[model samples]
Target: MKLLIGNRNYSSWSMRPWLVLAHFEIPFEDEVLLLSGDGWRETLAARSPTGKVPVLIDGALVVPETIAIIEYLADLYPDKPIWPADLQQRALARAASAEMHSAFLGLRGHAPMNLRANHAGKVSADAVGQDLHRVETLWGQLLARSGGPFLFGAFTAADAMFAPLATRIRTYGLPVSDTSTAYVEAIYGLPAFQEWLALALKEPWIVDDDEIDVIQGRVARGTLA
Candidate 1:
């Protein structure tokens, strides 16, 4: 199996599956397509039908989307227990992951992921507030149900799905409750997340638009206070 990812500094979508693969100690070849210049487009086009980063190629199989890649991994390695053991818990985890995959457009658009940025005081759209509220509600519900350290008592697919959101919340200094804040901290402190951050800090390829956005005060930085 081979996993194709994008530039570590700016590709939140790419981080999702990469983190999962890393966390589970999956041994696979990595192909990083730097998301600048012309190389990424050509490489992506050849590898993915959707021409996106974070495509997982397993011999004859090609999984393009991050969620699909995660699902594929879960199916292939059920012993790893990426999802919860309980049927109801597994269902809820899937629902949360799906929600994260499809919704939260407002937050995603307003505050693009930039791990190195430190803009301390920026605000996003009204819809972003709505998205945050929904996220907090979901977090509270899941944590209440499973009593985390993680979304489902242990790090599962649901946690992987929302990991980037935790990064976004931190990057933009978005408001979150005590429970949500703790959850974000837990995610940030994960070994996989720390590894990703370390790689991101060393990366040379910076998206100029994202850098400009950070400098221009379009995106807030630092963790939620």
Candidate 2:
């Protein structure tokens, strides 16, 4: 299987399935498609059905979209505990993942997942407060229910789904509950996540659209030193 991803520094969607594949020790190769620069959109359009990263290519089957790729991984590796073993818990996890797929626009918009930059106190609380409240409530409920270092007590696909959110929380200095903070730390501590972070820090490419400082006029594009 070959997973086509975007730049590690800025592609939140790419991070999800890559974490799953790496965490589960699944045998697969990953190819990086630069998310910006000349004709990058055309490149993605030609390669992906949805013109997005995190596309899973397994033989003739092509899976686009983050949640779909994760579902495919879970189906392909049922024994690997991609989702919780309990049926109800699995349903809840899927629900949360779906919410992550659709909701949280306020936070996501104000705080794009730039792993390299630290823009603490830059994002206005008013802009993302409601979204952060929802995230805290959801994370708190699940962590309490699971008694977790992760959402479901183990690093499931649900955690992978929200992994970039965890990065955003820290990168933007978003206020969250203690439970959420610990969960964020747990995500950062994961071996798979650590691997991704190390690669992200090393990446030279920058997506100005995702860079809060660049967008806010605090810094010139491509001038990060």
Candidate 3:
């Protein structure tokens, strides 16, 4: 199996299934395409159906979209348990992951994912506040139900889905309660996340326009606190 990913420092979509694969200790070759280059476009167009990053290529199958890739991995490695075993828990996890894939436009647009950049305490707009509220509410509910650490008491696909959101929370210093803060801390402390950050730090590809705005002191040296 092979996974095609985008810039390690900026590609949130690439991070999702990559993290899932990492968590399961799946061994697969990776092809990293630096974004903003014609080479990236050509590579994606030649390989992926949607011309996007984070496409999974198996023996004779191609999986696009982060969730689909995750589900495919889960199916292939049921013993690895990409999702919770309980039917209800699994359903909730799927719902949460899907919600993340579709909703939170305000936060997504205002605070794009840049793992190497740090823009702590930078609130974008009024709508951002509402988005944060919704996220925190969901986080609080999940944590309350599962009781600690990860969203489902152990690392699962839902947590992987929201990992980028956790990055955004830390990057923008979004308003979050103590419980939500703990959840974010749990995510950042994961071994897979640590490895991802280490690789991102070493990456040389820098998209100048994607650099977090410094005029408002939102980003400091491309990393958040």
Tell me the TM-score of each prediction against the true structure: 0.91, 0.97, 0.91
The stretch of ten residues in a row with the least summed lDDT in candidate 1 is 216-225
Cα lDDT for residue 17, model 2? 92
TM-score of 2: 0.97
Q: lDDT per model, in order?
A: 0.84, 0.92, 0.86
Candidates sorted by lDDT, descending order?
Answer: 2, 3, 1
What are the per-residue Cα lDDT tens digits for candidate 1 across 100-128? 99999887777778898764356454648
Candidate 1 clashes: the total is 1
Clashing pairs in 2: none
- Root-mean-square deviation of every model: 4.2, 1.0, 3.4
Per TM-score, what order, best first?
Answer: 2, 3, 1
List runs of model 2 lying over 4 Å from the truth.
none
Query: What's the lDDT of the predicted structure labeled candidate 2?
Result: 0.92
Model 1: runs farther than 4 Å from truth?
125-127, 212-225
Model 3 bad stretches (over 4 Å): 125-127, 214-225
Steric clash pairs (candidate 3): 116-222, 117-222, 117-223, 118-223, 118-224, 119-218
Give the alpha carbon lDDT tens digit for every residue of 79-117 in model 2.
899999999999999999999999999988889999998
